[model samples]
Target: MASLDDLPLRADLVGRTPYGAPQLDVPVRLNVNENAFPIADVVADDVVAAVREAIAGVHRYPDREFTELREAFAGYLGHGLDASSIWAANGSNEVLQHVLQAFGGPGRTLLSFSPTYSMYPLLAQGVGSAYVAAPRAADHTLDAATVTAAIEEHDPDVVFLCAPNNPTGTAMGLDVVEAACDAARGMVLVDEAYAEFAHDRSQTALSLLGRHERLLVSRTMSKAFAYAGVRVGYLAADPAVIDALRLVRLPYHLSALTQAAALAALRHAPTMLARVDELRAQRDRIVAELGRMGFSPFPSDANFVLFGGVADPHAAFEGMLADGVLVRDVGIPGTLRVTAGTPEETDAFLASVARLAPSPRP
Candidate 1:
């Protein structure tokens, strides 16, 4: 067998590992920020029926445009959006990869904040673009001034703004989005994969789409929709931005079954999202309880909470895993991130923490 070192791998990727969390076969899995709730059976049945119906057309390639699915997504999003402004792929990750392919490459640079989505750098590098991890505020927040300054300094070809950013679970104000759109000399992508988990839904970067052509807001069904296994992600942006992505996407990239299943799920959008409020409650509970337990939990607006004050994050993670609960050790010293799942999962996580977590650092 040949080793990776012996193969002709790209120099940038030679020593890099794939982006992922530990997928342990534990009884409790709050590690990946997934919607731990099972899909409503009625919705699941509809999805299965849709997929079965779609199987009849599997002999042919799917609709290259995925028109009806885009229309469904538009209706679901409902900020005066239509199919012309929607683009999707296997997941939000691929949707982002398409954006990088269209806008970032060898001579271009991609910029994002540290402790942001771990995949940003890998996606940029895979597209042959230089990646810059800009510094965030002292409290792990990104302010408008910091964003504008980074864009001014790097002159990057692409900028990623992960709203309600990952690992930290810190929400970004739209002011920061406004600053990025104003300051970026190139494409600006707002990753809102966890938007549904936010406390406020009235305003998002999506609201700014009519004004800025470079502004792109991406969304995914993998989180709040309990559709991670279905692999459906889409974005809403200016038609021109959608056009740019169309240029780089593979032919019939989205399979018919996926489109059918996603469309069926969207038809039950209300039912699919019924647990959002409950999940929000769980997230708040984690934040509050962690604070009461002497750990410092950040004010999160997403479906997960990132708490600090662990004496040994690795040990805490290991202990929790051994106790049949799994949380993410996102390489942040003194911090660990866990998804806000069911009430029972929360109970298990808290119990494991009480058993294993060390005293808070004064």
Candidate 2:
């Protein structure tokens, strides 16, 4: 068998690994930040009917523009957003990729804070853009001054701000977005994939859109919408931004069935989100219990908690896995991330952690 060395490949990607978390066959799986609840039966039935209707027309090409999906997304977002300002793709990851493809290329640069979504740098690399990571505060927080300073120093072509950030689950304030826009000479993309799970929705960067034409807020249905299986992610930005993305996205990228399923789920947005409160409660339980047990849990505005003070993250991960629960070891020293799923799943994870107590204090 010829190794990769024999085949011509992009030099930057020579030794890089694919982005993923372990998908083990564990009884209680809370590794990814997925919604713990399943879609409501009513919504599921609607989706089935929609898909059935859509399959009849699958012989024809899907709407290249995904007109209805964009409109549906606009209605769901509803902060004065319209279809002209919306863009959808397989997932938020793809949406971000589209942004980078249009704005970032060789010689251009992409910048973000450290310990953010692990995929940001990969997205930059896929576009042949240089990726620069600035450190966040000791507490994993990013203030306006820190962001502005980095923007000044790096002078990147694109800046990514992940709100309710992954791994740490720290939510950035709107002020940070405003300051970034004020300082950055390039486009600013705020990844709000977990916005719906935020403790306070008002802190969203969407409010800054009208004033800052260069600011774009991206969201995903995979998290709070409980529509991960459908693989629909969209963004709200200036109509011009949406227009730029159209130039790079493939023709008929979203299948008719995907459009149908996503539209059906969006119609019942309230019902689909009914379990958010329950999951939030479970998340709080994890934070409080971890602190009481002597672990340092970061304040999270997302579905997962990134707690520190572990003596050995790998050991805890293995011990938890041995007990039939799966969590994420994000390679952050003395830290691990676990999603807030069903009450039973939460109980199982808590029990495993209790058994693995006597961890090193931070």
Judged by lDDT, which candidate is best?
A: 2
Question: lDDT by residue for model 2 over 151-249, one digit each (tens)?
Answer: 999999999999998879998889999999999999999999999889998888888899999999999999999988788889999999999999999
Which regions of candidate 2 deviate over 4 angstroms?
359-362
As for candidate 2, its clashing pairs are none
Cα-based TM-score, every candidate: 0.98, 0.98
lDDT of 1 by residue, 1-362 (tens): 99989999978888898888888898999999999888899998998999999999899999999999999999988889999999999999999999999999999999999989999999998999999999887678999999999999999999999988987878889899999989998999999999998888765898898889899999999998899998989999999889999899999999999999999999999999999889999999988888878888988888999988888998898889899999998888888999998999999999989765556444
For candidate 1, what is the lDDT?
A: 0.91
Q: Name every residue pair that clashes in candidate 1.
A: none
- Residue 362, candidate 2: Cα error in Å is 17
